[model samples]
Target chain A: MFSNDSQIGDFVKSAPKPKNEKERLAALKRLEILDTLPEQSYDDITKIASYVCQAPIALVSLIDGDRQWFKSRVGLDATETPRDIAFCAHAILEEELFYVPDSSKDERFADNPLVTGHPNVAFYAGAPLETAEGHRLGTLCVIDNKPRVFTDEQKDILTMLSRQVTQLLEYRVINENLKRETKIAKTMTRFFENSQDLMCVAGTDGFFKEVSPSFTEVLGYAVSELLGRPFLDFVHKDDIALTIKEVGKLAQGHRTVNFQNRYQTKDGRWLILSWTSSPSADGSTIYAIARDSTVEIQKQNELLKSYEEIKATRAELVRPKEEAIEASNAKSRFLANMSHELRTPMNAILGYSDLLIEEIDSSQPAVIEDVKKIKSAGDHLMRLINEILDLSKVEAGKMGVSRDTFKVAEVIGQVEGLVRSLIGKNQNKLAFDISKAPAAFNTDQEKYKQILINLISNSAKFTKSGNICVRVFEDNAAGVALMVTEISDSGIGIPTDKLESIFSEFSQVDESTTRLYGGTGLGLSICRKFADILGGKLSVKSELGKGSTFTLRLPSLAAKKSKSSSSQAPSKKGSKRAA
Target chain B: MKRVLVIEDNEINQDLIARRLVKKGYKVDFAIDGEKGLQLIESLQPDIVLLDMNLPVMDGWQVAEASKVNPKTKHIPIIALTAHAMAGDREKTLAAGCDEYQSKPIVFDELMKKIEKCLGSV
Candidate 1:
């Protein structure tokens, strides 16, 4: 025993330590077997180790920094022992089997607590368990109460069991890693299958490698049909070039956000898709998410088409209106020029005739009479020219209203004074009734006076030995205050049919009225037009063989000027003639 | 006697106005166009000018503007004899420096009054 202690102590002291003790301990920890209940697989290996070595106790022990922890133990109650006295710790220092004939005889363990205390281990043999990278983590060891020598076969069996232990540890770690990877893959697949957005993986060769189930919902194609097909095959022809360009960018390891394109569906419909894609780090594949934008795109197109149509229609309508206005303006310009030409000669005729009448002697009554007739004829011709020019001015919309404040009675008095002579010549009685009229009002005074003159003259011309009444008063209707002038005559009455027609251009009661009245038939029409320009209305009531009464209703205050008239002046040369 | 210049393009109108002014005891000189009328004004230096608006070579507005700008002819009272009896004629002619405006198909009495008034103002 004295020689055994020194020899075992010498053997233990000469044992080679592992090259990486820290890494070996780390590998044992990675197996997560310390402080655990005995597992049947590990216990079975320990039991086989003991049976082959003919030992009473066996264990699968892991070497920590200061302790040896047993993963499985047979014929032993303690789960751990101090590393200084542990056979497995000593075994882990060697690449093969480590044996001690008697632990009490060994100098290193002669005074050890486990050797002198309960279990009283006397014999030990252990095989170091090594990782694939040569890390000796722990051992499969057998122990006995009596000192013994391990046979070569027993050592070989222990080594085989230790190799199985290493294999089992490697398998357990690989299986756990596989389980974690499968869980993550299952979650990702569920998200892909249930997501509304189209998710896909595409190869750098432009072919679809995988597509989410949402592919069928958005593009109307089965996943089987889309797989292995070039992504451009489903792209609209007009969009394929753009898709290729974007895909090329992806192939260059660029990420594209919101790249839009149109895809043709299986049923021959278009789906507008906005895609965000990123190329894999290796540039061998791309991951993309596509959002459907078909409805928004189509609505934008329809709106653009409608806008174009409306613009075209507006241009079409505006052209003819502008042309008509241009034509009317041209006519007005011609009339103004013509009137100047006509009146220049008329001026000479009238001026010369008055001189002639004055120069003729009173003794030659016959020559005086002839000159008077020429003067009268010239005056009549001037009136006709003036009337024609005035009608043209109103028709061309060149007439504008000029507003001023004037006394009502003053205007009526002037009208009465001007028309009194004609009424006397016709043997008509003229009466004025203007008591209720406003003393003064705001309106186009000249136009009002002209309208009154035309009406009174028409009355006097058609009336002989009859009464002409001029009534001016204020009236209210429809929440508007109006200045009403009624001119009633008791002379040749107009038929009901001719009442409205009389206001038309060059219209008269009949053909005979023009002959008998000696008028250009433009007076009433001019009056009505002037009233309209002043924002008023003119109406006449008459019966056959009775008399005609013409009413002029004018707003007391003028409204805003018409759009064309606001910028325009009254016909430059022809307005006075018309008035 | 007050000398009057009648600037008119038409022969008949010129003759008629010249005869009337002569009968009215005024010496009347006439020109066929505005250029001749301006020339006559320079030489004749008449008391009044009956300027026709539509004249050859230069229009009455240009003639009026020119006459008013000249130191010698600006003093002669001009009565614009216009065939344009429109609303703006008087203001337009007056704005060009005419003393009075009269429309065509002339009433001799009205023209005589305008001439006398212009002569009086000067």
Candidate 2:
């Protein structure tokens, strides 16, 4: 069909194809200008190109698969010719103007059919129609029947016209796309006017080039107030910095997805808007859609505030226990300081008093006894201070227990030795009734001895020419083992009401008990604290001028080879023996 | 008479210990601070040392460690004196290589027993 339509029966049909012939031909066809009727836009470019170059023939030749089709022509009769003989085909391979001063001497086209045939071309100049993407689609070229050279000015003019042709192609394609989308455009126009979402077109100049009617509705602004003004003017003062940052990203060709910022409405309220936008191909405009997220943002803020409130409320419930722990720690530290400072003066006082009693002459018996009173009083003050320190340690939880397995009788024996001298001084007869005591007990040996020492010593101090008997009893109740020790003394007994008060810290049966008995009054309280450490209870039952029987009850452990004795002990908790 | 050195800071304590030691018929010398005490310990080379552990110039533990570390003075026995007889005081004195420790407001008789034992060992 091509042979019949063109005068090319004798034309050479084999010129070298471009390395990208497949892609180049495909792009050329997509322009849809090949073999079509000539239009005035392309024709005008060729006419100007030929007049500027002062050439006899000019054509806007687009290279197709096997032919060079003229989309527009000046002084050319045939519309197209075989691709193998077309000069524009080879011209497309060059980046800039492809000029042949003499086609007769050029090796590649020396014998081209058009060169020696109808057009009889000897000189040619073509400026490649390179698209913005660098695709050389075709060329706006001029030809002469005889050999000639194009001037520098004429060459530049051809190049400029070639670019004009490429732009005309771009406009044509855009017009076609717009025509194809007319039906969708009509529907979109209705949606853009009536829909609630804010649709807009923005420019890199920071102004809203166009806005849908919903923009005016949502922001309560007229189209006149919204369109020409800078979009940043409507953004909240706090959000302008971020708004400019997002605009910079769009200018860099980055699509904005879910970008949110606050905008001031015409009615003087802040509206939180969430936006998605894409930049136009030229990167000079932005196409965007936004949703009014004010309600959603309010809901999120409410949720966050409630969560913070819950956290604060929980902290309030836990504050007092922590404060109590801190207070106890402070008490322990103060007591430690007192313990270190108070003893230094006492050491000198007691030490010098002892020296006085020792060095005095034997003849001055009254002087010796007077110094003896000083020594005794010093001793009494020292004991009171020591007892107060010990009770303070117990209250602060600084007392530590180290548990071990030992014979109950063995610990009781140690206590007996410590209190025997006091017992003799008081003229009190002591008795032990440990007939039913266990062979071995698992507990802190020192704490157990301390508890026993306090109870025995208190009994000794309280009684004069009276009897103090300690009785031990073991019971297996409800599969739980308990060891109970009773120290019953026939002493100046406590009154019924005073029995419970005696166990409290710094309390005596009566004020006279402290004077006559000469006790610090912290003995029973310290013993009770020690008992508490050993997981035991201390209680007493007494009558005035009859006797007081103090009971020490403990969770008695059955001796065994155990890994952790403390963990094996049943979790024992009951009401404290409080008066 | 065996010469005894008493390292005590307080003048009353120094006088008390000195007079007591003199009464016991031992020639007694006194130094007021740990630096002077360490110096007297090296120069005098007394038969025994009575060191107050909580002295201002040098604590008893440092003096003990310093004296024990020196080959010349290491042979001299040291008896440490502390004010408050806290539970860990004895172990601390022993760790410092003190031969014996006595609590302050010293009972001159009990301190005498410790001193005799230390001197008897020498």
Two-chain DockQ for each candidate model: 0.43, 0.13
DockQ of 1: 0.43
Residue A148 shift from truth in candidate 1, angstroms: 12
lDDT of candidate 2 over B23-110, digit per residue (tens): 8899999988899999999999999999999898788899999999989899999999987554457667988989998976587778
lDDT of 2 at B58: 87
Per-residue lDDT of model 2, residues A46-164, tens digit only: 98887888888999988888788889999899988877778888798888899998987776666677776778889999989887756777899999988997899998899988989
Candidate 2 Cα misplacement greater than 4 A, ranges: A1-180, A313-324, A358-377, A387-421, A424-427, A432-452, A461-465, A469-579, B1-4, B18-27, B34-49, B56-58, B62-79, B91-100, B104-122
Query: TM-score per candidate, in order?
Result: 0.61, 0.59
Model 1 chain A: lowest-lDDT 10 consecutive positions: A6-15
Write out the backbone clash pairs for model 2.
none
* Native-referenced TM-scores of chain A, all candidate models: 0.56, 0.58
Candidate 2 has an fnat equal to 0.05
Candidate 2: TM-score? 0.59
